[model samples]
Target: MPAERQTETIDGHEVSLSKPDKVMYPDAGYTKADVVGYYRRIAPIILPHLRDRPVTRIRYPNGTGTRPFYEKNAPAGTPDWVRLATLSTPGSSKGRDTADFPVVEDTATLVWLANLAALELHTTQWMIGDDGETRRPDRLVADLDPGEHTGIEDCVEVALLLRERLASDGLTAYAKSSGKKGLHICCPISGEQSDGDVSAYAKALAKELEVERPELVTANMLKKERDGKIFIDWSQNNAAKTTVAPYSLRGLGVPTVSAPMTWDEVEAVRELRFTPDEVFERVDEGGDLWEPMLERGPKVPEVEAPKRRKRAARPRS
Candidate 1:
């Protein structure tokens, strides 16, 4: 039997969890309490990836597989103790010039999000600096997604190509499942490069891969050309774009996690899907595989900016 509601002190803050036994993952029978427990246990590892990042949460209030909402602004009634980052979104469609997004700094905050059924936590490549503004992107990502008639195996092959290409450029690539039908190859980068520079570098690499293996890979985003190919989505490195934070859960009617993997695991992976229990077991055997991504490294290789074509002179009137 589970309590209908209860209060627990986490990191010096009291959080009230209600309907602990309510199933959040109806397929897996995972309840709200279970979600809270997972975040509590995974906090130490997950927080590093989340710290200083403004999270955009995908909330499934009624439970996974149900109608969900994407929450960018900090929800009303957020605890005063939780840190908020106010970002200026000029020309915004939401009709607000600024958004108060929550930054998870401690276990209590994570638990609070879990209580809200925020299963998917997405974040940008950059972190908020001490000055309370977004810093230069410190990470670059190549999101390799398999298209129709393709699957994990195709993604793995493309990832291997990426690993080799990155190594040749003196970059170390880290692998992680997208918790869906894709893989994300991340590299720690020196924060010296501008966000646009980093994104350009990623775009260059993706184009290079596409050239080398045209059959297995495609850098284009067109759906018609994606079938039977791996789409290397370099745009995820853009300053405004968000990728699923490592260790966050996916609401695919199951309790799958976006888990990090070693190069060895990536090389030999038959299936990229990993449930919460499997992730815990892997963590126990091998510490946080994503820890290395926090370190500063060399800047991404410079890319040649695309040359602008000259406009034709207007005909003499």
Candidate 2:
């Protein structure tokens, strides 16, 4: 009988699931069953997008005692439609099993996951910014957390301004909420660029933005320094830094907040109207608005630096 599984009640629904050997789901309210059911309901929709893509699975606890998280491929005998992965925090921490979903590499897989999350959880929120033109297949995303405020409108403004500056250089960008107190701005780059190159580009962009709008944007990583401002976190582009996978569930115990949005809507929002409780409802009603953007070309510009004007020698003083 389906391996005599465990079950739990979430939002008053009985969800069936199998527990990880040593891991635990982050949210106290969600049972192992709920987690498994979540995967099952969305698996079919996600598989076609992930077929034949090279993937890297991030294990929860990622070491001895932690369960193996599979990515890129489903576990042996599992259906091809099931794109499951395991993830663990470093050193095999027990409590960290909270964030152990396998991350699929294909963009289509991610989009499907996003759609499912939006449909089931009711947390579809969109943020469009000025860098709409810079969208590309190869992307570098940095999650800029604005602690305490978590205001979607404020975050969108930051994203738009960043887009404007990047657009001048012919780069395209997009932004979304973290489903928490910050935003994620993804820049399109030539996939040809390495992590280092992406980091360089992001750092330069953040630095330039900080220079132009010091009051609003800071590239600093220190929380104390970033008080009341958005930090342009370039570190996320580093191979070691992990930004939220597009559709992956967060550790918040509730459905995550990030949602794909159209540039026009991003510019139109007075504030974030969506919430986690409403994510699934919104998806059921309608899904992502930024899907078209996924297929668009890189929009970065090619411009040469201006020559410095040599000053004529004044009278020898």
Candidate 3:
């Protein structure tokens, strides 16, 4: 055995590993090499979804990359299925090694990886409840965010209202924090639907809410017009737009903003009463609520014809 290899247990799984060189993987026996190995092993399962997607590096508070495990000159035997998210940094500055991984594929996968990564890293700083499962989201997620506002309570309220509306339509929806300042509400839908179809559905839903509560929601793409209301941000479903990765930490230095919650809890916390510190404490206390939610699929409504809208009167010619 290599002198650096050490023995340890993770979630009760006994394994031998080396010490981590970076602070990102702080568990005693983990290393940047181990992180790379984990990705390589899971590459076949992960790459099909990740390849070709551009990845963003998560930076430390000091504006340094939190280098995770990835190789620049991946060996020939390295499966083409595995692709590096970005370049790697060699050493640490403040006695902390850094590492980076590929950008997450989507919001759902992001959550999945975040939970798993948290477990793997043994940070105790993050937690996912026992309820979180591996089931894929049936509903599409459209994240509307105004980059400036850090008070997420308003966004949470919007998501709850939207969830209520969708439920009234017989469609089930789920919500989670983006791990930043916004909220993400995922509705169960057939992935078979085209982007245009999904976008149209989202727009209709947003318009319905706008008409009902004109004081709060705005579907306008123009920032100048959004004012204090939440933008419906249907563009998130657009092929080019990206939502925060599920488990990836964001902001200046904290772990990613997106955290999963039960629909009931989502409604309860609509007031955004909890601080990130509170969220971290709760996560440690209760664990993730998403696993169980995965078992229960959304109650999708029967397909119906799109409702027609009346055209606005044109000015006299």
- Candidate No. with top TM-score: 1
What are the per-residue Cα lDDT tens digits for candidate 1 across 157-266? 89999989998999999999998888999999998888999989988988888898898999998999899999999998877789999999999888899999988998
Model 2: how far is 174 from its true place, Å? 2.5
Q: Which candidate order results from sorting by TM-score in descending order?
A: 1, 2, 3
TM-score of 3: 0.53
lDDT of 2 at 160: 86
Q: lDDT of each model, Cα atoms only? A: 0.90, 0.48, 0.47
Q: Global lDDT for candidate 2?
A: 0.48
TM-scores for every candidate against the unseen true structure: 0.97, 0.58, 0.53
Off by over 4 Å in 2: 1-16, 19-28, 43-137, 147-151, 268-277, 290-296, 299-317
Query: How do the residues 147-168 of candidate 2 rate in per-residue lDDT, one tens digit apiece?
Result: 4444556667788887787777
The C-alpha stretches of model 3 lying farther than 4 A from their native spots are: 1-138, 144-151, 268-288, 292-317
lDDT of 3 by residue, 3-61 (tens): 56554443333344443343333323333443334343333333333333434333221
